[model samples]
Target: MWEKGYQTPIYLFNKLIGLQAVVEVVSNHTSNALELLAKQHSQMKTFVYQNQLALDYLLSECCIEIDDYKKTIRRLAAKIKKVAHVPLSKGCR
Candidate 1:
């Protein structure tokens, strides 16, 4: 879930970078449009950096959650196994 949620923005940022590259290629032929595309490209680059930071943070959090969940499952399994191995003594119902 976390991956899906964060991947969209990262993907979009990559597309933006691609688009900026294409714009830059065209900007080489037009002096007037170069300045505008440059500004937008700069802002997009900043957003890409920020998005990367956010994705890193989200990945760390997801890792922590997965680790904790694995630990809990192991603990529960051990407890269940121990109970299953215990002898049933003769006692009053």
Candidate 2:
């Protein structure tokens, strides 16, 4: 499913940093995906700047279409929980 390997995790950490102007969530999301994003946070910041308008538009459009918000949150939370515990034996340490 992940085509880029680890070079670009969630591809949104830097965007998030740009979105909220905060570095706090970096600590919250240290899993594989988030870890990848965190590694290039400096560049992510720049990427966000270059695409803020489009990013904002995309996020806004996405949020507007979620009819079952609670279910979506639960599903996302479950997925995040699962990903957080990925066993080291699956690949690299």
Candidate 2, pairs of clashing residues? none
The number of the candidate with the highest lDDT is 1
Residue pairs with colliding backbones in model 1 are none
What TM-scores do the predictions have? 0.32, 0.23
Error of 1 at 88 (Å): 99
lDDT of each candidate versus the true structure? 0.52, 0.47
Q: Write the per-residue lDDT of candidate 1 for residues 1-93, one digit (tens) a residue.
A: 557655787687767666755665454444334444555656676677677678878786422111123344444545544443433247511
Give lDDT tens digits, candidate 2, residues 1-93.
756654355465546445443333332363434445444564555566657657767776322221224444445545665644433344432
Candidate 1 wrongly placed segments (more than 4 Å) = 1-29, 61-93
CA-only RMSD, every prediction:
30.1, 19.4
Position 5, candidate 2: lDDT: 55
What's the lDDT of the predicted structure labeled candidate 2? 0.47
Task: In angstroms, give how far residue 23 of model 1 lies from its true place.
Answer: 21
